[model samples]
Structure formats: C-alpha cells, structure tokens
Target: MHRVKSDLLSAHIGSKPSKTWRAICDGIDVLKQGLIKRIGDGATTLIWACNWIPRTGIFRPIASKVPEPPVLVSELIDHTSMTWKAELVRNCFFDFDSDVILQIPLSMRKQEDFWAWHHETNGLFTVCSAYRMLVETKKNREDYFGSCGNCSDVQRIQKEWKHLWRMKMPSKIKVFCWRLAHNSLPTGSVLKNKNLANTANCKICGAEEDTWIHSLLQCNISKCVWALMDEDLLDLLASLRFSDPKYWVSYICCNIPQADGIRILVTCWAIWYARRKAIHEGIFKSPFSIMIMINRLIEEFEFVQGIDFKEKDLYQEKSRTHNWIAPQNGLSKINTDAAIDRTGTKGVVAAVCRNDQGGFIAASAMVIPHITDPETLEAMACLEALAFAEDCGIRSFVVALDCLNVVKNIREMP
Candidate 1:
C-alpha cells in the first residue's frame, strides 16, 4: 500500500541480517515499478513522467518536439463535458500515443486518479501477474524491464511459492513449507548458531548435525518415516533435485500427482511434529504407527471439508433466492457491501440507508487502502453504517450485513 510505503519504505536498512525487513523494503521498490495510474479525473497524474496509458507498453506518452513546461493529465481533458480534448490530444503527442489516449474511456462519475497494476485488466496488482511481467520480458534487464541473470532462478522461486500455496493441504503445513524454504525452522544447527543450543547434533538421532535436510529427510526418524510412505511417493521425491527444499517443492508442483503431493506434504509435517514431541515429551512413536496416523488424519480432513459437487451447486442455488426484505415498521435499515481486491491489498466499501418503505435516506462509499480481507472490510462497513445512522438521527435502525462470521461474532460478543 502507498500508505505502508510512506511509513516503512524510507527506513534505513542499516548493516543488519534481517530477511523480513529486507523483503519489506524490496517489495516496496517492486510495488513502485509495478503500479500504474488509472485514468480517472486525471488531475493528480503528470503527463510526461507517470505511467497512465496501459496499452502503450511503457505507459507514458512521447514528449512533444516543441519544448513545454510541466503538464498535468488534467490539462488535456475537456473538463466541461468530462471528455478528452481530441484535437488537443492529437496535436500534443505522436499518433501512436494519441490513439491509445483516445481509446481510453472516461468515467462519467469523474472518479479521482488512482494507482493500479497495468498487468491486470481489472486494475488490481497480483504477485503472479507481476512475476509474469518480470519473466516474460526477455530483453532490457536494466533498461526497460525484467530482472537479471536469465530469470530462470527467479521463475523457479516464484513457482515454488505459488505451488506450495496452491496445494490442497492444511494452511499450517503450507506455512511450514514457507518456513522450510526460508530455512527458518529451529533445526539443531540453527539453534546452535543462535546460541540457543549447546550442540548442533539432532536431539533425537544425535548421529548428524540438525540441518534442515538432516533433520527433515536424512535423520533416522525421518528415514524411517519416508520408508513407511508409499513407494511411488518415495520414488517421486528421489527423481527430483533434493539439493534445496525449495527446489523439491517447485518440482513436486510441476511433476508430481496432486494426491501424491498432498501425501508428501502431510507426511513431512507429521515427521516434524514427531521430532518435536520426541524432544519435548520424550515420546517417540514407531514409524509404522506414525504413517497410519498420518493416513487417518488426511482421510478425516478431506471427508470433513470436501463438499459434494451437486450439493454445493444446490446450496448456491438456494442462496440465490434469498432476496432483500424491508425492515420493521418505523425502523430504518442500512445495507452495506464491499468489493475486496486481494491482489491490490485494498478494497472499497459502500453503505446505503433506507426507510421501512424502501425509500433511500442516505448513501456513502469510500476507497479503503491496505485492506485485504472480507471480514475486516465488512466489519468496517458495519461501523460506517452505525456512524451514518447517528449522523442521520436514526436510533432504531437495523444493520444488514453479508458476512455471516462478522454477524455471529457480534451476536456472541459480551
């Protein structure tokens, strides 16, 4: 978010070895290069320096041959009718740039100019789209776009993140994969490096240093667990590069079967859990027993969460029939809605208040930056509705919400 950038982007990353801090700062730089201004009122965008024109690869118009002072995008607009000044636009820039500018549709509502990701048609920025833009640009690494060093390594890392998150596994296991990729797991060597442990050997095996690979895949317990897993899964793991945990994840996403992937991930999680339990509680379960428990856990989780296709469709059909109803007599109702842009990490929320007879009393809408989730936006909408009601001098009012979780929390609040 631009607001977030204002706060942290300027902080000096002094001689420090912090992955999280460096990531935040680097991400801010990426955001700056990726974001383009959407043409709205165009009052805030500069003509020569800003990236507003999406169709023109560079997102900027060529400079007029005749020297001119700084120009705002608003200057070219025919403000009285809320349209572009066609003749002026043609005269000011080259035909290529002029055509693209003319093709851009003007908003009748006269919305303010705002930043959006040009890579996405919907004006929302996503990591996937950004990654594609970076990797697809084969030339001009330092000039126009794209990253350095062939971009294959960059592509592989991004692919790993995407595949790990996309796999049908529990979120905890996915987070574990993230930790594994970052090498953040508290392996014996990692602990000793931080002076948290006196020795670097595994607490369970004690035969090798507790590096991620040694503790996760090569230790006696890990080897036993892997041995108990399906033969096909073990073979798939062996076929891929095991030099790095991240490489294994990327290859699995690309080459392995979905069911096999889930099985492998869940088994790895179980192995890690057993190791922790062995160190803390001094309880070590047999590899055969652990494999059985892992299978049961996987089956139970799938059975509980996987909805039937026909039933899901029928439920959706039933939900579609629930229409809006008028509030009780002498009471006002406030209906609130929100559109979330998960990629952009922001959203817009709007609320409409009406009388019992469906007569519109008031309405309010605003762009909310740095908001990523539905529940938080819906909760904020409810807050806004209450404020709107108070301002309208309406005390007996019912707030209608679309989020069931927020409603339940409100009902259960003491």
Candidate 2:
C-alpha cells in the first residue's frame, strides 16, 4: 500500500477492483490532495508540483514558459554546500517563493525524500483526519450554496468567535461554550434535531425545551443561579432581550466586567454539570449548591492565574517555586518530575533524592511507553520517587512535586 504512486490514484478506480481495494484507492486520492514533501535529500520530489515549501504549501513557477522536463527539488540545492543554490532558485522562482524554498531545512541525517500527510502530526494519513476534512468541505459547500436566511446565524456566531476564544478560561471550557453558541452541543434539543433523542424537553424541569437558551438561561435552576448575580449585571442581562443563548452570552461578555462575565460562564457550565449528574447518577444538586460550586471553581481558577492576589501579597507570603529546596541537615529532599509529549502517547518520569547540602544521593529515570493524563504521570513520578527512596534505605525524607493537586492528595492520605 505504501508503494502505490499518487499519480495513479484515479487510474485504478472503477477498474473491476474489489470493494476494499476501491475504498483504499479512493482514500489515497483524498490523501494526495493533502500530501506534502518533507524535504530530506529532495531527490525524488518534483520542484514545482510538490508541496515542500512550508509557508507557500506548494511551489509555483514564475516564468511564462515551462521547462522541457520537470525540475527536480534536488536541483535547487547544492549538495556540496548542503544549502540552496540561491542564484539558481532566484532565476526559476519569484522572490517570495524563492525565500520560502530557501527556508526548507535540510535533513541532518541526509535521509531520502518522504511524503508527509500534512493534516496529521506524525506525517501519516489517518481516517479521522480525512473525515474531518470532508466534513469541513461539506460545511464550506453548504455555506456557499445554502439559503441566505441562515447567513445571519453564521454572522452572529462569527462575531462571538473573539469573545468565546479570548476569554480567560481553560481551552476545553471555551470549546464547550463555542459548541453551545453554535447549537452543536449535545443538549436534548440538538440530539432531537439530529434524530438521536425522542424529545427535547428538559429532563430535570420538564417545563421547557432543552435548548441551549432554555438550559442555560430560562430554566428554573439557571434562573436561580442568575438571580444570585449583582443587580447591575441582572439589569444589563435583562436589557439585552436576546432569546438566543449565543447572542446573549456574547453581549454579556462584551458589556459586563470581565470577571463577572467569566463567573456567568462558570455558572452556565455548573448548571450543565448539575444536569449531567441528574441524568447519570440521579443525584441532583440545588441551584444554591451549584452557585457555590461555580464560585469555588472561579476562585480556584483565579488563584491559579494569579488574579486573586497581587504581586506584593505573593511576595509577602512564602512562595514555593517549582524547584528543589534542601531539607533539614540530616534529612533528604526527594524531587520528582515527569515530561509528556503533547500527543500524550509517551511519558518520562524522573526522581532524585538530595541531601541538605544539595548533593544528589540517588536518581532514577523511567520511560513510560503509554500514559494519558499528565496528573497520572506526576503521580507515577511521586510513587517512583518513594520507591527509589525506600530502596536507598532513606527514612523520613521530604517529598516535593510541582503538581499541587498531587501534593494535596498526599496530604489527605490516611
């Protein structure tokens, strides 16, 4: 399958091929569009046609006349110097294009040219990435060809994009809010719209439709939470008069105080959380309880972001920097840390025990093949540190970790 040429993607289609083979060939055609060259030796890639240049995506010829034979990517680079032949590149391509061509890094190991699936991180084709691309393509087509009446919805959502993304909150929370704004959230109304649910009525209240607006704004629980807000905020919220949750959120975020706007978002999420608990566990939390939960969460987030305390206050208090500190004279200080790649496919855990004089007594590093949660990785590091200390015959050592949650868990242990 890896040996199949991209140019023959269409030639094999509908040629009495097996269903699986046909599917594979069709998939190859899709990947070909996103296929890019990771310039190694650059010997096999065509200069003008290959998507090798990082910025331009694909190389384009500047001259009106075409070359008799296609220019190879290797022709632009001088193998002796291991750099671009600047004069040759300038003559063949435009200034900007030439600059982009020059920026392509030469391989350190001088490996052979390889095709990169630009959509994926590992430079390989994936069904999920291809499906996402197709979904985006279909959405673009609908946006261009669909009715003019729905354009207003798209426009309104576009205006809210900045407000949703720029808010000082976690990425997951922002994404959840964005989904809510688009009515793409997995609420009962959305599920019903998708024919996945029997009814759109709120499972908890049963009085109104479980739409984003009703769930987050008009529901009795949501109303009680909103009522807890300051009168000025309540007045501003009422004056907006927008029934759409997305517009309501956007307006409030734009007009109200930033902290209050974040609090409102937190409250909405809290209401959703309560509904989730009611659905999953049959244990419903009251509006006041949910409000308290939201406040606690906001307070925690504020403390993490350093918004709750001034620099002077932080300076006055004993701050624990994420570094190793010596224990008392006879005691040992064990410091543990873990590093996980962005993909979360692999993790590395390391721990070291040092004496009060700052001399490392013992150290151990382990490569974890697979680990998902970063907190879990930190916990693993701590556990390994403890084991290392025990094996080294150390007693009553001080353990230190940058992860406060892990430290809290340790403190709460029996």
- Leading candidate by TM-score: 1
The digit string of per-residue lDDT tens for model 2 on 280-322 reads: 7999888788878877888788877755521232213255574
Q: Per-residue lDDT for 177 in model 1?
A: 78
Error (Å) of candidate 1 at residue 329 is: 42
Question: Candidate 1's residue-wise lDDT over 1-414, tens digit each?
Answer: 213334443455557637876787778777766778887889999998888886524778866844673399888877786668878887888887776677565554557998877776556677998787776553545534433443334435555688778766778988987887667889998898999989998888686688888877889999999998768667777776576666666666556556666677788888999999899999998899889889887786668756232132221224447666999999989999877664754677789999999999999886665454567578768877877787789899999988997887677554
Please give the RMSD to the true structure for each candidate, in Å.
Answer: 13.9, 14.0
Q: List residue ranges in candidate 2 displaced over 4 A.
A: 1-11, 14-20, 53-70, 78-103, 145-297, 303-414
Point to the candidate with the largest lDDT: 1
Cα error, candidate 2, residue 344 (Å): 28
TM match of model 2 to true structure:
0.40
